[model samples]
Target: KGWGHGIKTTCVTRLDAFVSPEGKMYYHRCSVEEVIGRKLGPDDNLASAKNWARQQVLEGKDWRGKPAKFDPDARLFACLSQGEKEKLVEPGAFHVAVISARRGSGIV
Candidate 1:
């Protein structure tokens, strides 16, 4: 099910941060590619990404330094809504996914 809008790229800019449950912040310089997936619209791509993240957690893999809730480097918290933050999973093992980059740098 889709709205039938073909995926297209439009130049844009956004400021975002990835945070941990503990309040540590990781800055993310978002790009259209990182925010949107290839061959799929942003909505579809984001859904896929979320599903992938859930799978990673279920696989018993350590997220540390990568992008899992249990990961020491998972910065998803920064973007999470306040209500979502209140429901954070594995609060004990959350950590910021730090990134250092200059302005206008691409994620990939």
Candidate 2:
């Protein structure tokens, strides 16, 4: 269920933490590709690169991190609005499928 290999080339410069309305915390690790839509080069500045990554997410591009696999049923969840998604991920609503980028096989 995980992306076959690591696609990032820079260290995470910042972590964006989200607190669900119900009090759960989710931290998103920003990646270089998520920022610039490409891999990082040797000359890339870790600090500046991370800021760019953060901006992309803030701007609504879905470049959060490495790709992962999720339950097929999760597609239905996609129809949920952002507020609904937060509620579902709360302490209890139903089983939130484990989203992974390392599982090679399963009901992805």
Candidate 3:
């Protein structure tokens, strides 16, 4: 089972894409790994890395008002919207990777 904004108890077997509030596309890394039957190494692109970092900062806020750390395994890519094209391409637009998993659920 999965849980998040507009998502609940959902099953993701493939690389399901999700759009962030800032209009970025995030894909399930596990699903991608499953499809390719292999794990992915870091590509080390500056934009992608910055996007991931920014996302973490935005999503790291917990309900209890504590800073939370983002998951490392949730690989995501930013899909630049028309408005975000330039900003996303430039450096430092706050972001991070988030992955939701439930106890005993293989939905990660």
Please provide, for model 1 over 5-98, each residue's C-alpha lDDT reduced to its tens digit, 9 standing for 90 to 100: 1222342645344333233444432433343343434554446545654665677543332344444445766767899878767857888866
Q: How does each model score on lDDT?
A: 0.45, 0.47, 0.47
- What's model 3's lDDT at 39? 72
Worst 10 residues of 1 by lDDT: 1-10
- Residue 17 of model 3: what lDDT? 53
In Å, residue 3's CA in model 3 sits off its true spot by: 25
State, as a TM-score between 0 and 1, how close model 1 is to the true structure: 0.24
Candidate achieving higher lDDT, 2 or 3: 2
Work out candidate 1's RMSD over C-alphas.
20.4
Deviation of model 3 at 55, angstroms: 24
lDDT of 2 at 105: 65
Task: Name the runs in model 3 displaced over 4 angstroms.
Answer: 1-26, 44-108
Comparing 1 with 2 on TM-score, the higher-scoring candidate is 1
Q: Residue 76's C-alpha lDDT in candidate 1?
A: 65
lDDT of 1: 0.45
lDDT of 3 by residue, 1-108 (tens): 011122223555433453333434446656545554677576523456456556656777442334776665343334445575544443465668566654546654
TM-score computed on alpha carbons, candidate 2? 0.24
Best by TM-score: 1
RMSD of each: 20.4, 17.3, 20.3
